[model samples]
Target: MNILLDAAQTAARLPWAPLVDEIEALLTDPTVQVPPRTVLPMAAGAFLFAMPGCDARTAMTKLITFTPANVGTATPTIQGDVAVFDVASGARTLILDGPTVTGRRTAAVSALGARWLAPNLAGPMLIVGAGVQGQAHVEVFAAALGVKQFRIASRRRASAEALAAHARRLGLRAEVVDDADAALADCPLVATCTPASAVVLRGQPRDDAFIAAVGAFTPQMVELAPELCRAIAAQGRIVVDSRDAGHEAGDLLQAGLDVDAMPALADIVAGQPKARDARGPVLFKSCGWAGWDLAAARLAAKSRPTG
Candidate 1:
């Protein structure tokens, strides 16, 4: 029987520690194969994404929709499912909630990047944008990194307060801030989770800060200003999550940074030597990849009920 997991069930299976470990393992696994995702345009600036990946044991594909216009609406902006298949027998096995998988995996990717790239986590982390990704980042970082303090900022004050409340409920200290740029000075960690076309973060980061830019994936969208990206590149290092980031990382692309020349997360995980000043500011630009979804599917598959 094919197993179908809803949002809560899917999330329950993908615990933070195991999910992060799975992603880290696959980062260096040569048998893993993930083709470039295909993006089809829909009316009113929506997008349909088809992402597929496979390993020696399992094959999975995540089909999802991205509708930017649904940001404030009751309907979520992302919706779909991840279908898992048995590679050897070519039998469908499991179906997991798509948005839940995407949220957890994307946040885990950032947490993994921080584990390798972040200089220190002594100070509070600053989160710009209080949407789904923002909340996920807070939860994952706190659970995975033992982070205890957070600062939330968003264009909508109510949203920021809500995220702050959510963080407090997790037994972490959280404060709502008015300016993300100003908060950059005190935070050793920063994450920009907005989907804005223009820049949402400006100014320079702290000398030893690790910033995860996860909002803008397409070449046309950006969260960090071009100048800020260049500043980080010149001062420290900018690591991308995958090779697809060469074209999908808008923050780096808009800044005219040579993404192909930068070190990928896989290289770092493989013990490659640093290419830039390791003690200075660091930025991790994440463009979503199917490999991450595959990792999630692998985890969910382990929880499948047997006859």
Candidate 2:
């Protein structure tokens, strides 16, 4: 029987540690195959994304919609489902909520990057944007890295406060900051999760900071200032979650940085010596990848009972 998992059910199966481990394992597995996702423009500044991937044992596809216009509406900005299949027979095995998988898996990738690139996993991580991605990052960082303090910033103060309250319920210290740029000065770990066409975070990050820029996935969308991106490329190192980031990572592209030269998360996961060294602020650009969804599917399948 094919199982259907809603947002909450899907989230319960993908705990931070195991999901991160699955993603890391897939990074080095030669049998895993993930092609670049397809994004088509929709009406009113929205997008339809089809991401597919397969490994030796499992195959999955995530079909989701991105609607930036729904930011304040009752509807979520992202909606869809991830369909998992048995690789051998090509039989559908499970259906998981798309947004939950996207949010959690994306945050897991950032947490994995932090494991290798962060200067320190100390308190007071700064998260720019208080949307779903922002809250997911807080949950992953707090659970996986044991980060206890967070500074939340967003275009909407109420949203930031709400996220802060959520963090407090998780027994973490969280505060709403009016200025994300100012918060950058003290935070050794930072994540920008806003879906902004213009730069949302400006200025140079702390020298020892690890910044995960995960908001912008297209060449036109940008969250970090181009100048700051250039500064990081010049002084520190910029790493990407996938090579596809060369075309999708807007922060690096807008800054005219050669993303082709940046090391990928897979390279880091493989323990490449050059990718391990962090001389200055390390910026991890995550543009989303199908392999991550595949990893989530693998984990979700493991938790379910076999027929």
TM-score per model over all chains: 0.96, 0.96
Model 2 Cα lDDT, one tens digit per residue, 172-265: 9999999989888889999999887678988778888899999999999999988999998888889999999999998889899899989998
Clashing pairs in 2: none
What are the C-alpha RMSDs, in order, of all predicted structures?
Answer: 2.2, 2.0
In model 1, the clashing pairs are none
Q: Which stretches of candidate 1 lie over 4 Å from their true place?
A: 272-277, 304-307
Stretches of candidate 2 exceeding 4 Å from the true structure: 272-277, 304-307
Looking at model 1, report the run of 10 residues with the lowest lDDT sum.
270-279
Model 1, CA-based lDDT = 0.91
lDDT agreement of model 2 with the native: 0.91
What local distance difference test score does each model get? Answer: 0.91, 0.91
